[model samples]
Target: MNAPDIIDFGERLLVPHVIKGETQISAEVEHFSRATQETVMTPKLDLDALVWRRHEVGPAFDTPLAEIIDFLDAVSEALDYDKNSYLQEAMEQNARIGTLGARILENCYRDIATFFTREAATAEAVGSFGSLEALDGWHRQSIRGAETDIRAFPPRMVHILAGNAPVVPPITIVRAALSKGLHLLKMPSNDMFTATALLRTMADVGPDHPVTRSFSAAYWRGGDEAVEGHIFRSQYYDKLAVWGGDAAVRHAMKYAAPGFEIISFDPKVSIGLIGKEAHESEESLANVAERAAADVLAFNQDACACARFQFVEGDDEQIDAFCSALQSEMGKNTRYGDGPNGPVPPQEAVEELDMLDMLAPLYHVYGKPNGGGMVIRSSEPVGFNPSGKIINVVQVNELSEALPHVTVATQTVGVYPQSRMGGLRDALSSSGVQRIVRLGNHIGGAFGGLPHDGGWPLHRMMHWVSAEV
Candidate 1:
């Protein structure tokens, strides 16, 4: 059979053992492929089996934390993409459905194992809750007149995952296992097979384990009312851990009834700020430019944490030099598995830059518009979003001038000089930026146990119940 036929024949969803009787209905999995700029259909799902019933909550909630960690560690060991047939199949299927290329996907799959280690799982539990004891059972505390016992109880949740990055599935899986929640992953079209591949790997390691049985992965059209309208009810799920574009979030909001809450990871943008100190010497300028390149080129600028607009403090001459150097640095940095030519920008965006280049002095366009990576410097922020390894370097008199441009939609800001961050952090926080990091550190520096989008997600994934005695 051909690739498409094989994909179509495989049933993508897992039918939990708790589910009894036959399938009431079935549907084809469908989604738009951003990679091919077309619609792609893959496999079928037993829709009735995807729904969670209150009485059918998996034993994961009551399973001891240490055992849960052990299960997760075993899952980590089983995710070796080279050895596992499920992941190897996922690698092949995802290459066709996902936006990322094969090599990048392999790297992401390899890194997924790192997050599932016992050390990492324990850290997640501790970071989310002050004490790991909270997840085990109610811990006692005293008030002025009364004593209270509080526990972080798992809630039945549905994670509407995004496909921009392939690592999201494993991230959600880790969070769900740590929180001991009943999870139903609504896989995105761009990359549907990964979550199912992960769960299948876990099943191999622990077939009868609670954590293995706790997860269910499926893909339905994002706004399919017949499917969503039924499972999105408060009776079926307590929380919806949503992540996607604006339309996806809006669709989920409609289902946010009295009891079913939405923990939204809204679509966001990131920016960079460079202080005047960057121009104190040629070496300094070179160093900052290289750092700036790392931020823009990360995940080929597809990540929300990747900086799109950069605010620099310097004269037009100084800025031009930095822009030229930044463009050169972007071409050299391919650590994120970018092609030799780098990411190709959209033809429309390149055309806009071409027009801007004709009006020189007002706008400086450095590097080729091709996948070689380009830097566009303007006195004001550009009108469009930058991607395809493109970075918009905006001129600023001082780093503080960039503060007004920051908004709630801004997720991260990478500052050039370490000293400048202390002064701007308060204003950046007030303006709604969730994370602030030094230049070149956007990829590894801003993440881990930290508040994401504006909140601690692990905390939000569970219900903190208390009883006064």
Candidate 2:
């Protein structure tokens, strides 16, 4: 059986567990292969730890980006799927799904549900944090220039899924779907489950949901030209949506098919800019620190948008106090895995934190990351390599200076004072960063479908057709 031209994920199902002794997503007619991380049942292959399974041949690539766009235009008109209410719908659905999955997954979905809730609100406020509606608008505008520049080619989209954060995939999935463009989703092996779940949910909502077809999420072992090569060919996807690290994206760019366009959200290095006011009152310090703690636990600070560093505008004493408050906040992260039966994080993360001890005053609180994570620490700056460790505090004279060293992966950087945001927004995007936020809730935000890469538009994902009647 051929895959649907568009899939809702509700009807199409998971494959049966060939392993025989474990729960799995089951279905028949295998034409695609998926990857999973190194599992007890599956041998490890390089860095890809996904469970690979072949599925039925997907519907023809003949649909093309132009046809995809026509479908979106039709859906946009038919469902009156108010391009603006995506966030509200997402929150409602997230809550519904979270409740539904709670008993089965032991409430593993609670955090995800909350993530959707928080991000939805953030997206609505900012125009890009949480909904498909918000993203479609922005993607449309981004493609406008490309539409004018070139006229009959489809977009080659490369989306790099970020494992640091969760549920981020759906935001991209929806945007690409509505843009009516073909999608090349690079699934982060670690967080593939959520996107898979959300896809299932979209199907539950309806098969004709734009998400049903027009997009294909897969794990091609990063640079496996066999998969990416054939798919990213010049005649293939027109835009690329990257959601991983700098190295991941740089490598992805190599496989970028010729004549195809590449639009990406490369690795984002985010920070927290705490104003001296945060330290003015003891209560404020504690309050802000708790907020920092919440941010830390949100996806355990894995997103490029998550705050890896902070520029506290104050003297060492003030900065130290904020650091202490932050440390206090870190101590409260309990979402880590449960008992021995639960998931465990990498020992390498612990080792990395240990290395930080050589530089700064450091400490570690025991907790599991996968399920049982921890708060690893040091007073000095972390080794700077990406691993586990949520908030890093650095005292700064002005928050703006920290922008240069920032990697292109910088997604969301949270600033404390709302008043100073106008100036900082200019500074944040002044470099290659995407969102400059005053509220520190950076981990779970994607609304209003704003230009995700610092006002970068979505029209870049499309090709134009100009004809006179």
Regions of candidate 2 where Cα sits further than 4 Å from its true position: 1-160, 184-186, 208-211, 218-220, 333-383, 398-409, 444-446, 467-469
Model 1: lDDT of residue 429: 98
After the best TM-score superposition of candidate 2, give how far the Cα of residue 351 lies from its true spot, in angstroms: 5.6
Model 2 local distance difference test score = 0.48
Q: Write the per-residue lDDT of candidate 1 for residues 120-206, one digit (tens) a residue.
A: 778777887776777997888997878999888888899999988877888888889888878888878777678777777776677
Candidate models: Cα lDDT each? 0.79, 0.48
Per-residue accuracy of model 2 over 1-469 as CA lDDT, tens digit each: 1122222245332321111112133333232322222221111222211211123222322334334434433332322222313222333333232221112222334333332333333333234223333322213223534432223333435577775444566466545554444455555544434454444434434455433544545443567765565565555444566666678778767765556555666665676776777877999899887666555544445555556666667875676667666765665533421222222345776566556555444443334344322443333345554334445566567766666656556667777877777777766676767776665577444343466666534455555544332
Q: Which candidate is the best by lDDT?
A: 1
Clash pairs, model 1 backbone: none
**Residue 305 lDDT in candidate 1:** 84
- Model 2: worst 10 consecutive residues (lDDT sum): 14-23
Runs off by more than 4 Å, candidate 1 = 1-34, 37-43, 337-339
